[model samples]
Target chain A: MRRQITGFSNPTVKHLRSLREKKHRKAAGQFMAEGLRLLTDALACGHVPQVLVMGEQRDPHPLLAKLEAAVERTGGEVIETSEEILSKITGKDNPQGVAGVFAEFDTSLAGIDRSAANIWLVAQALRDPGNLGTMLRTGDAVGAGGLILIDDCADPFSVEAVRASMGAVFTQKVAQASWGEFLPWLRSGAGQLVAASLRDAVPYRGAPYAAPCFVLVGNESRGLPEDYEAACDLRVTMPMKGRADSLNAAVAAAVLAYEVLDKVDS
Target chain B: MRRQITGFSNPTVKHLRSLREKKHRKAAGQFMAEGLRLLTDALACGHVPQVLVMGEQRDPHPLLAKLEAAVERTGGEVIETSEEILSKITGKDNPQGVAGVFAEFDTSLAGIDRSAANIWLVAQALRDPGNLGTMLRTGDAVGAGGLILIDDCADPFSVEAVRASMGAVFTQKVAQASWGEFLPWLRSGAGQLVAASLRDAVPYRGAPYAAPCFVLVGNESRGLPEDYEAACDLRVTMPMKGRADSLNAAVAAAVLAYEVLDKVDS
Candidate 1:
């Protein structure tokens, strides 16, 4: 349906603004994403926004026309509102010309298809939305199946994360589960659980990596728990040649993901 | 000298707070850093803060006491102030109880030693402070000699960049120059300018990489100028299996830096 929202206090605008917070997003089962390019990428991935809100001042683009048609064809709501309301809905001083409301994807462990790709990215207790999103982008770059968030990770649906993903949010799968749930799920499937550890491990460069590898990193500061590292089917170590003892969680995941990608392929 | 500043309006507090701004920091040639650990790391690197401010109700630690003595020994100023004032100076809600003012280090292109390490990182028109700091941390991870900012990049001395660097800012060298200046400088020394590109490129895996290798990346949104790519000694492309076009700038640097490190060391 086509509509227009001229007021910032409109019920639709309020509902859209509510999605910016975690509890409201959980209640509505929807999350907000901005930027025309991001919504376009989401369309390319066969995911259409349930509600599309655009600033009336937005410059016309053919790609945006395609996105609007796809949303309208899917029985989605398309609302053109004043730029001020758009900024209010996005909670930004200078908002992107477009924003969309998408229902949260299936993030359950059982939903992940292990056979989809040769590499995967996983994080435990990741607290930063930017880092969480960067890992998703890294997974997309390395052809990883998805990112599995373990135990109290920053919400991947948060606006900060979705923006940082740079459209990877739509391309890569995302799964969330506790350690107990993820460990058993992996064991039941054809996968290799690998982690960067300082334990009895091999160098990350030439480590014997197998297909369907899961690259796991831990909390930003504490790193992987001792038992978690011990449980890995294979543990690899990246060289830390400076005063800082560890790499940033997302950067570490990307480096390890590329190594796994290079190794398993050869 | 030892002193107590209970008032937020104190001139020292005002000056320290100003360091949070780029213009003020440039005028003062000093930057503010918070967190006892970061200050300790700075101290360990023989960089005693010229002005050390502590929260009045701060916990007592041996390391902190050592830091205070070192500041005093170095003839630097040490002040105990209210947490509110500390927060005002650090521009953080929950201040880490300690903050310091350190003079900005030399970021001249001539100061870098080409023979310092096997790998180096370069960026052209990099905008984000977090990405700049992450690149510094990645450089530290791969034992890269330093990070060279080739054009208009984020200020390395900014609070966000320093905090994101996780203390790598002190360990790794930093240099800033225009593209015109950087090209001639690299040519004058033994360094390979490697960038992630698809133009006449080879697979990033096992590509011929040489030390004193400089892995260059461009702005976050715009990958790199075509002319810049044409100038690279080696252009490599990492596989993109998913829909997203590229990796995050810092993540790309980390991935490429590791490859260069692995290849050159052998």
Candidate 2:
């Protein structure tokens, strides 16, 4: 059923506003996926929203109707809110016409089907939400089986990270673990682990990446810890011919991911 | 000789602060390159600073001495101000210890040595400063001869762009021209023009990228205009196997740039 919310002080409005913070998102086990395209992508991925919020000025579009039907089918309520309310809920000057509050689906490392999973991207202490999200999108692009976040990484469900993922947040299986926990899980899987490092590594192009591999990227500033780099099955370096010592973490991940895909396909 | 200015109201201090804006940078024909690494890169690129500013808390170091000596040899002054003054000048709560004001070097298409220049990156109406700068860094990493910004692109000298470039702004040749102007210059050069487009394009890996090629990338939102795509000698598309319609502009550029390098080297 569709409900009309005329004021910002409504209880539902207050509930949606609280989701802008990580604590509330965690407590509620939900995150806000804003904009029309993200909501559409979430629905397409079979992620039904807990609540759908739309601006009062939103036109009667087929996509919006489809989203409303999806939410209704899932026993969720759709609320039409004024622009001011929508903006307040989104913490933006002008919020997109639609936003969906969906439940978080964090998977465990043990839950993944090993037979179907070939490649995994493991990011260690990745601090930038945008970089983490872009890696998720890139991992999805290259058809990686899953993403593993290790030790003090940014929240994958954060608004900035979700926005940067461009809907890959819905399709990609995200697993979180500590360095110690991840090492054992990785060893049990028996996949080749390729780490990108600048020190004492073979050229990335020349590295032989066997199947069922996990490509590990390091943090933005400090990079992979020395112990972690040493632990990997193979260490590879992307050539840097310019004055800059390193490439952006997300860019490095994309390049390496595509290269891995090429090698696997060949 | 090294001189120190302690006041926030000093004329040199005011001049350095003005460079934060594009208009002031244009009027003075100079831009501020912040942080120790950027200043070092500028000096290495033979760009003698007009002024060097440092926070009072900065420790005396050999690198500082070398930079001061270089500035003195070029008839430039080195000033030391309080942390408060440096913060105000940089618009950051905690500005880097060192910053340099250097003259802008805008190259023209006619000035480039056609015989020596093998690859050039052409960005049309790129809006984000960070994306533009990342492309510059990637171009530099691939040993691209230069970067060409066409029509309504972000200023390369903007602080965000420069910081994102990670010193590539100092080493890479940057040229700016309108589409009308660039088309004629490109035609006169008689080099291959490969446009990265989504429509009716061959796979990027399979595309034949001849030497002395100009790889054209489009704006973040709208992408390349249809006419521009039609005008290119060849059009290539990066494979997208995910829900996202397109890759981030910088990632796409990096992937394509590396592919071009791989093809050339092989």
Candidate 3:
């Protein structure tokens, strides 16, 4: 089905705009991603948007036509929206020409396959959407099975995070759980829980690493709880050679992910 | 001298607010940093603010008092302002209760000591302030001497970059030069220019990373100009095991920085 949304008061426009918020996204079980390139990536990854929104004046592209055909094949709705409406839907002065609305993925621990890859990234209390996105990108780069969000973390499906993920949002498996649930589940699996720490930590480089390693990082300001670090199978520390006390949470994860990949791949 | 700023129309308030924009900041050769901790770190690094603005309701802190004394000793001005004025100056709904305006540092290539550290970070055409900030933090973690901005990049002294840097903006030396100027200067020194590339590139792991390694990252989207990559003394490729074609620019730098650090330190 195809529709045209011309006014701000259109129900579909409101529905699409509401996906920008967490509560609305949760209630509807849907999230929005903008940009033709991003939507094409989603389509390539076997995710057909339930509703595709395109600016009326978007330039013609072969990939965009393929996307339209795929959406039609999947019995999806298509909306031609004005630039002003696109701006309103995205809350950006300069909106991407195309946006896609997809059903939010299964973000439960049960959805994850523990042994799918040699490395997995786990973050706790990560509040920054950009950091969550970066972790997804880092996870994709290292061939990690996915990213496991423990405790209170940013919404992985937020527009900011999705944009920052650079399409890794569709590529990476994202699951959310409380630390309590995560620890017990990890204990039941054949996985190594490792963290960058100072308490009884060996140097990160040349440190003992076991796969499939679950490389973990803590909050931006408070870091991981002492007992959490204590529970890790391995505690490795990266050197802080300057006045800055610690690395950014996502960078720490990237540095650790690469280390684990080097060891496991070798 | 200490004075009270009760209204938004005061020239001092206008001047403080003006520092937030790039043009005004450039004209004044000063930038602002907010919050007590950041200002405290700045003072610790021997960077006394030329202008200190505090909210009238701010809680008394010993460090803040020390900052006031230091600023006064250096013949600087201090302003006690209302929360409304503070909010207007900072453009944040909840003001940090304190903000400091410091003279911009020397950003010329001549100010850097190439022999001071084993690693240095260079970025070309990086547009995100947050990414620029992350590079600074990464450089600090690996004990890099500073960050050199090649070509047109985000303003390193921008408020967003400084905050994201976690005070590394003050810790790390910052220099700005065109690629034309940077190439000749680097050639005159004993430094290794390295980049993450796919052109006859070796795996990043165990690659030959020379001391004073300048780890360079290109734009967020456009990797690097072909000629630029050709000039790299070492071209290392990180394995991309998933659908993501590349890592986030800063994350790529972190992954490579650690690999280079690991090889050099060994």
Candidate 4:
């Protein structure tokens, strides 16, 4: 049996709404995942929610029932609330029926399993939440070990990013570190550092992407700075035939990541 | 000398605002291309703006001066407006210093130079403007001949879509058609049709994308309808190793487009 809450001012609803803000999310050490698909992905990825909220659907869908059972099995509270309250929390006119508040997965640079993982993605100063999420999803798709956010990247836990990530947010490990801290790790001879740059680079397809590789992509606008490019073991460029100078950051990342995967497997 | 307009209620400003709406764009057969880079791309692509608007800058950038010269050379009017007016027209706090109102490039299925082109992109019922723009940019990167928008799709001329295109909108030929009208032409020995589908498909890389190929991508949400899949000469799927069921529409398009380009060139 689940509790029913009709009031919008409920403490749980307030907490869920607060998760929308970065400050609150950081303070509470939790983030909100909306929609049945995201919640199911969260659970499948071994992330148990602290709280699950569902809208008042008179006859609950089978998937909803399964999700509810999974929550209960994990000792998480399940609340059946009015659609209005769910919409309020999600800030959408007609929100998805299911939402979950889950503790953020804590990943550290020291915790990454370098021995077992061959490929990694490093995003520097990425600002767009949607692009960050798309990169996370692409990273997961290519079986990258994890993502490292170097200096002032968009919050991966934000609603826009989480939504854009689909379910990859739960599956991919994400770490935050400054360039100064990350440089030592790259120079530690753990792997090859491949940077995507527009200057003095071999074509991406022609580059020999050795195993245990870390592919570095830069900000959407500025790209990888000169010093950062110099630090990389190899630099690769994608061919551009049109007037536009660059591909979208995430698109470039996907193309590079997939190329690396193809070469590695071959 | 360029005309100086300071009033927000000026007819030119009103007309510029109206271009934001689809109805107005369709009626006028024109769209707004904002930002210096996009305007420059438009001019480089041989698209003469009907009107060019520049925000008041104490010292105009050299690029701005060059753009004004080009517009004047093409017998187009250049207007210098206050930043506030520019900002209001664009709905951005700090709008780019330059914008251009250009007539839409009228492309029809009958007008495409299929004989000279090897690759094309076909988007069916794509709803998101950003994804559409990204696809345009990706298509340009791969040197696709043109893009065909099938059935009901978001207006490619929308500001969001154009901005997302990163100025590729000027270089790429875009045509609109219904599915009923497209199938006959597709089967008229025009080209090979390759559709991306998750069902009964080989890996995308394995697909034999022969020359004069039209790579088809479905909508962001529903994907291609079953009958549409059946209509395709070949169906291909991208390998997804993670929990995500599908890649971002734009990312998927980029990956497939590049793969096609690689095979065609080899």
Candidate 5:
């Protein structure tokens, strides 16, 4: 049933506020996604929003109504609330007047067909949420097979990450695991392994690409974990002659992903 | 004069804390930089720290004595304080036990001989500080003639930018100006102008590099301003085959910079 809750003290608003805190997100098994773009992307990707909340002053954006209809088709609930209530719920400087609570995806790497997929990305210890989000968006653009983040990575579901990702978070398949779990694939010879490093790695442009190869990138402040670097079949470095020795994680991911396609096509 | 400030409540510590506020940063025409790497880079570039603070239990790293000696030589003040005081000044979740205040540099285009410099970067409305900082560091590596920032850019001295730049902020010559002030050179044919855009522009690799050129880039969310786009001698687009239509600002800058050098050296 759709309801218009005007007061900030409303129960629905309170529940939305809880989503910002990590503990609550875990407890609810859901997280809040604000803005029409993200919600639309989530819906288009077969993810259903548990509840769709809209501000009374604003009708759903044209595309948003189609998304809401899709949500209802999935037997989800949609509600309208006051702007004040949304402001209180979002804990954001500017509320987008639309927000949704969606189920947290438990995407895992179990039984994935690596040989068929052209390219995959392996992120090692990337700690910044914004960087991770951007990586996901870039991954979506390149039609990546999937993204596997080794332990000690940022939560891609964080608001900052989601915002920076520009809606790619919803479209990509992401899984987080330890280096131990990833070792079997590295040794499988099913694909090539390229590790981006600061020292002694080949230029990224020239790195060889075999089917099902996974490019591993490290943390922003620190390079990849020692164990992960040792696991790579080949190490590659972006040829940097400028003052900065490294590129932003997302940028590196995009460049390498393009290189993968370039090599495969040629 | 160098001094030892013991308590968190010390007046100097309080003043340092105030500098964390943007208003104070602007009012004093100064900024704060943290971590040993940035401090060392600042000193290396002949940019002296006005005040240096270290944790009580902290011994300067391998470069400390040299840094302190250099500080003394430059007529700068040094202070030793408890870790608690350093924490108060930095307000970072994890304090590195080192912090310093340095006079903001205002490198003008006036003294720089643009024609002789040959290579340069113009960041148009880059909103992310980290992107700008990373671009600066990369610019330094490539030996860019200078960095010119358009309006609405992040303060390169902001803590996040400094951390991401990995100390390139101090080494690079940066000039902040509006399009009107910075574009006269391009108009006068002092140098070629190459603008990065998503408009099916010529591939970066094919772009000509005959003389000094300003590689212009825009904000992460927006491409170059219309007027700026119309002014470019050529609009170059990085070859992107994936779903992502574009690259991160810094990464695009790095690729474009490399492409410029590629054309010149070829």
Candidate 6:
């Protein structure tokens, strides 16, 4: 059934706005996915959208029919809303005219036993949502065991990250935990730890990555915490040839992920 | 001298908004750079901002004084305006409340002769500004000879790309040319042409990167154009391990860039 929602004061719109906050996303165990391609990918992955919000200004994009078909199969709810309501929900100038609220996948590394050959990515306190998304994308592409988010990082489900990831967010298993919560896993004798740092680090490719190891990337501004840096067995750094001191966080992660993958494949 | 510009109608503010259009940016030969770090990097790179504008509500950022000093040394102009005016000029949120209008650097690869050892990135019709920016940043880090922009790509100078690049847009020498214009350089007999495709191509690492080769990255949706793909001597593909049929554009480019760099460095 299709219904029109015009007022920003509507309860459905209010609930959508709350999804933007991390606390709400966690408490509800759901995150909002915007843009047509992402929603379609989620449906393809067998994740059902609980609610579908359509912007009133758009007569429904060409991809809407595919989404509608998926909704029918999943037995989901469809809510049509005005452009003003979507703009407020997104907090942006342009609304893509479609959004889906999907139950967040329970991504936990708890069951997987660490091994000497398993590769993992440890993202420490990255603040940019887009960078985190890109990191997850690269991590998934290289078949990393899992992505471990430690400390104060951006919300992985923020619209920007989801968009930047280009559907990788749904496929990757990302486990978010505090340093204390993750300490036991880090100490697990399953793999070596390779910390990425500018100081006291050898060239990334020069470091031995044949062993199962976790690549630890630090915050956007401050490098990784001293404890994490000191705890690692290997410190690897990318060689900088230009005047720019460092590459973007996502770029650095990709280079490292590819290096690890290439080493394993060879 | 510091002056208060109260209204959007003010001459300076009007001129800044005009820059939102591509025609004005081209005619003035200037582009906008945002955030404190990027503006500072531009100054350090010896490119002065023609106009520096910031939000009036917030206290000056620490780098603002340094920017003022740099502007004074370079004989440039700085202006303070309300947050609303800044919002009007950038057409994007100004959370940092700092932005600068920089004179675009006119770089051409015309006179430089290509050798078999040159590592080049050819971006063919990329649509996302952030992806383009990240690609440019990665290209610079991996020591690509230069970035060659093909037809129908996103504007490298757009605010999103500039911010995503983290000032690499200025640091990397990028030359824009159409397919016909780029044909001569590709046929110069200096390097192998490797196109990245998802077809029956060799694994990227196994593919012989004989330097002086140009790595071709296709559009976000269509991949590379048929003509460009046909012109390539070798096609290399990154082996995928997951459900994702392809990788992010920037991530793909970074992987290829690193592989090429490793080949040359070794």
Chain A fold similarity by TM-score, each prediction: 0.97, 0.96, 0.97, 0.95, 0.91, 0.86
Ranked candidates, highest DockQ first: 1, 3, 4, 2, 6, 5
Q: Residue B172: error of model 4 in Å?
A: 0.5
Model 5 pairs whose backbones collide: A141-B243, A141-B244, A242-B141, A242-B142, A243-B140, A243-B141, A244-B137
Q: Which candidate number would show the highest DockQ if scored against the true structure?
A: 1
lDDT of 2 at A146: 67
Q: What value does the TM-score of chain B take for model 3?
A: 0.97
Instruction: Please identify which of the two predictions, 1 or 3, would achieve the higher lDDT against the true structure.
Output: 3
Q: Candidates sorted by lDDT, descending order? A: 3, 1, 4, 2, 6, 5
How much of the true A–B contact set does each candidate keep?
Answer: 0.89, 0.58, 0.87, 0.78, 0.38, 0.58
Q: Which has the better DockQ: candidate 4, or candidate 5?
A: 4
Give candidate 6's iRMS in Å, 1 decimal.
1.7
Task: Quote model 3's TM-score.
Answer: 0.96
Candidate achieving higher TM-score, 3 or 5: 3
Cα lDDT of model 4 by residue, A1-266, tens digit: 68999887889889899999999999999998888878888877888788888888746677677778888998889988988999999887878888889898786777677666667888999998988999999988888878888989999999989988887888888888999989897777678889888888999986899878888899988998899999988999887877767888899989888888887754
Candidate 3 ranges with C-alpha deviation above 4 Å: none
By DockQ thresholds, what CAPRI class is model 2? Answer: medium
User: Local distance difference test, per candidate?
Assistant: 0.91, 0.84, 0.91, 0.86, 0.75, 0.78
Question: What TM-score results for chain B in every one of the models?
Answer: 0.97, 0.95, 0.97, 0.96, 0.91, 0.88
Give one digit per residue, the lDDT tens place, for model 3 in B110-198: 99899998899999999999999999999988989999999999999888898789888888999999999999999998999999987
lDDT of candidate model 4 versus the reference: 0.86
lDDT of candidate 3 at residue A29, scale 0 to 100: 96
- State each model's C-alpha RMSD to the native: 1.6, 2.5, 1.7, 2.1, 2.5, 4.5
- TM-score of chain A, predicted model 1, versus the true chain A, to 2 decimals: 0.97
Q: Which residue pairs of candidate 2 clash? A: none
The Cα error of candidate 1 at residue B88, in Å, is 3.0
